[model samples]
Target chain A: MVLSLTLLFVLSSGADGRVMHIKSLFASPLSEPRVGAQRTINLSRGTKVSVVTTQDPWVRIRFAAGTGWVLNAVLSDSPPGKTSSLLDSGADVSLNARKRVSGFTSAAAARGLREGADDFSGSKFRPDFESVRNMEGGYVNPDDGYAYILNGRTR
Target chain B: MKQHVAAAFFVLTALLPVAGAQSGAPALSRARAHQGVISTEEDHGDLTAEIRFGRALAARILGQYKLSADDKTGGYVSRVGAGLVAMSGRPEIRFHFGVIESNEINAYACPGGYVFITKGALSLMSGEAQLAGVISHEIAHINRKHVVRALKIHGGGGSFASGIAAMIGGTSDSSRVILGSLMDRGMDLLFKDGLSIADEFDSDADAQENMVAAGYSPAEYRRYLQKISDAGPGKTTSILSKTHPPLAGRIERLKQREGRLGENARN
Candidate 1:
């Protein structure tokens, strides 16, 4: 019965998402956590689990026995047949900006926030730069983008 | 027999995912679950898939940076990163470390014992311990399986699934273009906006513990954070937030943990 259950879990866990191999089990995402301890769930290498939630660097997953958290850094979203080189190159920031502005405008409208007033125009809050240049022996950029915060926007 | 059944039931109950799925279940809830199940001798086969995938991606990424395998600085980074991993108590897993030639102050870890530190980030470290803190924190991300969990929640089969799908539909050269686009998007999410406050705190706590494990003062982790904070706003371009919880909050947390270390510690 134990073997059958384990097999069931193994199969079920991999159905929805890629099976993530556990690298290390350090501290849990709970209060008063400790490190370098052994765990039953162990988060062993080759252990398969279904991703339940994703937010930033943390992911929530369900194993056969239960659900737990995983760091997004440790797992690959290995879309099949993708070239590794293409993924390594930097993303198109200009395209991202267009999408972001549209999203921002929609969100602002939903919240009744004003738009197109140049309220949130500035690069201090955003780290968009053409290239990171080493400036005059200091971390200053002669063409460093200006910093701007939209009125009523939290910086 | 009854006792055995009862014990099994207890273990199962402990292993069960937290119920109710409350949005505000205290940040430490996940850590508690991790602590409840960890034990030596447990099977970790699930981690292998991530390691294999990570190795392939790292190889490709490093190759693009033109970082030679024989580079001394790369070797130094690996040594320091591996040193922190050694403190994790599970020395069976060999950790691979590399320095990515980028001007972004970021460090990340992928499943399967692979960790990378960027030159931009390396240039900012004032001491070996601080670097160790960064490496240890990335290690903690691996240990915690943060990436896998995130993908499952956002959309199963990992983000790499889409990239792979793109590749399968095209030739090698075309695939490379697709892959690069996918990778760039991935980097933006991972480095620029994917990290959460909870994730940051977990890494912070793990770095502190790993520092102690490696025979360094955990307070050194605190000191590095203070230095970064002192560098003032905008000096460090966090892909996450313009200004994270001010240095004051981090200091307070460190003070709370300091009691565990005993007397004569300077504040």
Candidate 2:
């Protein structure tokens, strides 16, 4: 009885510490919250960190390497590389099957959820989805983005 | 008696976190909430619905304004936007950036992750940072789900029919009518009523944060807004003036944020 109670206590208290993951393609942890501060290491996306505190746009976090500051926008509650596949596969399954399986998809048909916005296509003007797709297709490589940042081209 | 003690201890320990979180977690809670990551099955359905809605909205916008044929310009804008997206905390929805042929100094963001800047808006930007500021603001709107919330476009499974039902608090049988009505209203929201001033200000603040995170100057956003404000009653500025709050107010807020952050930096 004591052991079971202790396990329950541990599980319940665990929610107190929230883990945030790096959302940016690559984030360099700074020694301070300010921009132009010294950076010791680059953390890749989805790297988990325990947040210590926040100063609005910046968050101080503790990771395997050490404690450092990263921008708040560079963190998310969800793990990276999980959402897209979930959405895609979920879309492929028929609405009826999904309804039988889960409440999430049970009302999908009633709600008009589909893989893409193709169902909403009866606008007076022909929707230029082709162009939107073309735009989506042309992703800027992450390496190019890093190069852009390194060069301070935007600065 | 010992078992009773253990049970009581377990309950107290479990409740402690809840009490502590209630006392000291507003900021963290707000951040987690704003991230809006799809964590549950319901969120998954809502997000899928949001994407579909956004795609249709993008199509409508594209129909109204032709995409700029200049690949180089489009590519440059895409690259800058990509950097902002990296820092946006919304990796689930792949953002697509494009340049439209309109000469108006305005940018539009659809619910999903579609962003477009007008050629005139592009011309107004002095450099890539300024462009980042602009794109970041639009990205902020999408990231924050401003349109989605305003339209009440989440829940009720996933179709426009059900979304419409949710919005109107009634049922609709015709999918076509439902979708068309929703699209028209969304268009009106973008082109007519505009998002609430609070939403605009929130995006401005978020834009600054995103800019700084992406290694760009938030001041550039201030400068761009100032430039547009100074340009005055021209064709290029007309749409923006209607769709956004006064530039002076936005600039003042940005300056205040800068001052606060600067103080933090000093401390």
Candidate 3:
């Protein structure tokens, strides 16, 4: 019982945060957050990593993409654009069987999320830029954010 | 014609905010003095309107570059952004963070709390502090409402979409078209002319302060600026290329204060 409790507390306390999918790069979860400490490896959008521990606001994830420690604010509990994928001609957009990821077929479509949530074609423009706006609003509370930052940016 | 010119002058001056207003961060004392006769109770109304206007502009930027298809990347940015905002002077505003897929090498801030960074810009970054620096600058812009000030036409002090239209209502037909097109003017700032050089410098100073406040190294911010400066001219149409050329002075300013940022640089 004690072992299980310890494991549960460990998992919950240093809870895992997944790498968010977007078009930016992340610092190597540095050996330390400093000038010489900058790691060459970085995590790009779509790679999933796990957290080993957290020191305050900094989340410590041991991963190969070079990001060893990152701010807790950098990780997302959920993936953002899961439905967005590159589909080949004649293949259904919904089909997940294909492993290959490609760029958008249409420039207009790729400009934003669909006009409506269900419209995956992504070609039409809606007056309401919901997807864009939502991405901006996805902020962690300051108190929570500071706690994450307290975690050192290190390996 | 002179009457028209006089009216135009009035409108232009209204648009060209004074020291406090032009900076977008009017001193509290100045604001209070300006509003000496007015009730503080009405301040809330102005804030509400400001937030509403910011939201509309953010939506328009979304129209420019949709969110990246990779959700985690968006999430990652938000996390970094949230950390910065948490440490900022204005933590109450719910700031939004997004990475546009365009290779433009740019970042933009909309009033209210909307910020967008491009993949090209991210590709150029070396560390989290650099990212925070770039973002802190944008957040400063947002916090200061610089772009919002630029977009706004005073006098009537109403909806951005309609304020300019209202200001130039009695003018010639061509001017009316120009007056109505706020989006065109806003785009010009993002894609062409960029903010007034003064605004950029002010934001740079503010960004460094915010980065330090958030426990990130301002030197990283300086390093990022150096990298961008070293890259020189990029795509002919690149936003950074066109607007940020004045960065030599900016670089000098950062270098002058590099020692202040120090090793830890944070409080």
Candidate 4:
């Protein structure tokens, strides 16, 4: 059938030892496939590795460091450009770096919503920072997320 | 000959996952599956802006509805949501999932990564797939940056020097006023205006890909929507019905999408 031929063509297009690069915005943890597996390493964005195998949502990859599993979503066939320094800098950038990054905040300042708008008062809805913080504090650890997937996966 | 090659390429792209599964190697990034509709790129606006704006909006939503104290249910949803988030193509941002104590069968996704599902909606889900389906839908909205793009809340410094204090030198009283007004408009969008129909359809399409890639049943998502539709237009379903397109229409579009992808293409 035509579909059969197309499938064959597609499969043949890709070869063994296919290379992929990390496409996640931040560093991604390469860990064992199983639930509660220890992280093998944290591969930064754009790190290239060879594909070893895959499970749904997890791909086993062979990097220079070692072979381990990574989320399939984090792998891209094409290498990504340099990650955005502004977004990736986090809270640790030096004072000079902050000056370079001040454009973003300056724009917000122009709009009257400066960087620290916490003292924002006179709102009809009493902003409940405490409750929001509590909710955010209960982040689901990646290990727990993997366990949930393992337990819930029917296939 | 050219037409034939094009057709083959289309089929190959569609069936890449099937080949990947058989070869024990990922065929292509699942992110590509969504690239047609929603680009995997996340350059909507400033990262700090999205988070701060989302947090502020979340606080207001919490102001309206108290969070459920059921740790078991909350933890379960959080775990499932987190797993999906890991593969959501927007892993850079931390996501928070909360269950609010509301009888209304609705869910809300804030601009950044805050997602809330009402207890009433929780009761309607029959199984984990159904829950995943719903959560995936909300995740789609967040990943797509629907609210953020619509609100136009952009540009903020990174988490440098306690972002607020760093801006104290530039603070104007008008900034507080502008932020408050922005919140008011945001509330209206959540409560009355609702996102565009195009956005809803896009989210549903993205959710289908998310569910299929995550090894959950995409059909179950349609089924969940059916369940909501069957519940009829009552108080519990009022807000959902008001905000979203008719469930019947959404289901039909999903069917069309799945048909295009072909059943075998889904995991």
Judging by DockQ against the true structure, name the best candidate. 2
Q: Which residue pairs in candidate 4 have backbone atoms (N, alpha carbon, C) closer than 3 angstroms, thus clashing?
A: A112-B175, A116-B164
Evaluated at residue B235, the lDDT of candidate 4 is 87
Q: How would you encode candidate 4's per-residue C-alpha lDDT over B42-87 as one tens digit per residue?
A: 3322555566668788888988999888888988898888877655
lDDT, candidate 3, A60-136, per-residue tens: 67565534555433444333221111121222322221211112223223533222221111122223445543553
Per-residue lDDT tens digits for candidate 2, residues B101-122, read 9999999999888899999998
Give me the overall lDDT of model 3. 0.53
Looking at model 2, how many pairs of residues clash?
A: 6
- TM-score, first chain, each model: 0.29, 0.58, 0.36, 0.41
Model 1 per-residue lDDT tens digits across residues B151-206: 22111122333322322323244323333433343333355445445655666766
Error of 3 at B189 (Å): 1.7
Predictions: Cα RMSD each:
19.6, 12.7, 15.6, 13.8
lDDT of 1: 0.44
Off by over 4 Å in 2: A1-17, A81-118, A121-126, A141-143, A151-155, B1-36, B158-173, B263-267
Sorted on lDDT, best first, the list reads: 2, 4, 3, 1
Give the number of the best model, judged by TM-score: 2
Worst 10 residues of 3 chain A by lDDT: A80-89
Off by over 4 Å in 1: A1-155, B1-45, B56-70, B89-93, B153-186, B240-248, B264-267
Candidate 3, residue A126: lDDT: 28
DockQ of each model vs. true complex: 0.02, 0.24, 0.09, 0.18
Tens digits of per-residue lDDT, candidate 1, A1-155, equal 99999879767664345444343333232111122222334444335566655543345566767765544433333211111211112322223434534554455445443332211121112211111101000111101111111110233
Candidate 2 residue-wise lDDT, A1-155, digit = tens: 99999878765444235688887777888898776678979998889888777787677887888878887777887676444421233332223422323432333444444323344443454687656655655556444654666577535
What docking grade does candidate 3 earn?
incorrect
